[model samples]
Target: MIRRMIRLYGTWSAEYGLIRTHVLIFCSILEKSHKSLIGLTHRVSMDPSARIYSRFNLHLYDIVVLVVSNAWAWRCSTTSTLLPFFHKNLGESAHLDVGVGTGYYPAKSVHPFSKTGNVTLVDLNEATLSTATSRLRHAGYKGTIDEVQHNVFQPLPESLRGRFDSVSLFYLLHCLPGRMEDKGPKVLANLADALRPDGVLYGATILGRGPGVSHNWFGRRLMGLYNKKGIFGNADDTLDELKRALEGCFEEVEVKLVGVVALFEARRPKMK
Candidate 1:
């Protein structure tokens, strides 16, 4: 355990160093480019690479800032939606959220049991971290919750292993395109790898007809034609895929569709 701790610490330090170096480079480019643009500021100037970089940075940064500044809102919804499950199972302990967007599930909200609850919010945005840190300190919650900005595409950090009593996955998954039947089973398998044996998972999504199906079946030929444009994942894909994902991971899973929205609940299988 001691060796693992040391290794993890070293890895974190190295990651931080890399992040700092990248930030410095980005800033240097922005500063030099902005200065050079002073003369052309009046023109509708654009750089495709710069625009893409700026947008990517902005998206990550917004998540960091928003998470910290918006803890309270998260608290309310979490308390109502997820707390009861935690209370019934682990009885008021810390929890972790994967792909926790802007600390919305754990911080600054009216958790009546707030004093005993600790939340760790994880994301992959530095701008998000900076903003969240400032917001947390300003709210006088300087160290109550833990924050991590890393990709969850691989195994979760060891520091978080077996630490959460309940885990929540909000409106995640289904961002990438896939046909309905194939998509759900694959993503659920991924989520299962990260889950605690006794933990509960909850989430929601929007649903509709499969992309492969004709849009004109309901007397809407124009709408069917438009579906081929392929912007968002079709509802059929999301619905069936989510169901399949839960089945392999959770011993028991339930789903409901309310109008256009679908809700899901799953639990990691308990040891026999």
Candidate 2:
């Protein structure tokens, strides 16, 4: 047991450096005694590449971690449930996925959308976009697939404005930089602009404050430390804040907190 723990620590340190590793360990211990202390130590800014998702590759181990691990089950559940909802409402309309990593949801739920319409996959990471495109192709997706390397923080191409009937930002907002109050609404507005009038917009985000925040001690510690390291920027993004952001951009917004995730579906009002 001690050897396994040592190996895990070594791996973490190798990836994130000794200082971060020590901080994580110290926070994990502090969480058991003074949980609030962990919250006080989070950093104000973080480099984009510091996030594990940026470094994550589509590999056998990553596949297993995404599919089989309970820690990631919330993400799978949110995508599985919401993607179908988006497809049912989309009906012969174009669809867009922002930050389509490894194309997991697209590969699994895109068949229905692809049968009658086209799909676009956008991401900042070229490698991730390439992997996602390949995965969709390998999954026998015969529909037109457009892969664009772009950052969601910036305005989308003029050609793409109001082009999609459905736009998904699943597991995306929390990974972005800056506080949710300032950044979340901006990102949502950008995505909302990409949707046609009355079009549906849906996505999920990992919340920083919620009922399930403390369910897993190790998970909480990891999240806290990751926030402190700037690997995640959702430390202040709660369920209420997410709802407010969505409501500000769309005519109707519905948000639900399932575990540590905030799942939402909204729609732009039809042009008068």
For model 1, residues 1-272, the per-residue Cα lDDT tens digits are: 99999999999999988966864564455445435544443353322211221323444434422332112211213344343433433314655555444443334533433553566666554444454455545555433567776554445667776665556554444333456466555555544554466666666544554432222222132123223323234434445556766776678998765433356777765332
Give the Cα error of residue 68 in candidate 1, in Å.
Answer: 22
**Most accurate candidate by lDDT:** 2
Write candidate 2's Cα lDDT for 146-244 as tens digits.
888777878888877888878887778877878777887778877887888867888777787755453355446656665665556877778878887
Residue 234 of candidate 1: its Cα lDDT?
A: 46
The number of clashing residue pairs in model 1 is 15
Candidate 1 similarity to native, TM-score: 0.52
Q: Total clashing residue pairs per candidate?
A: 15, 0
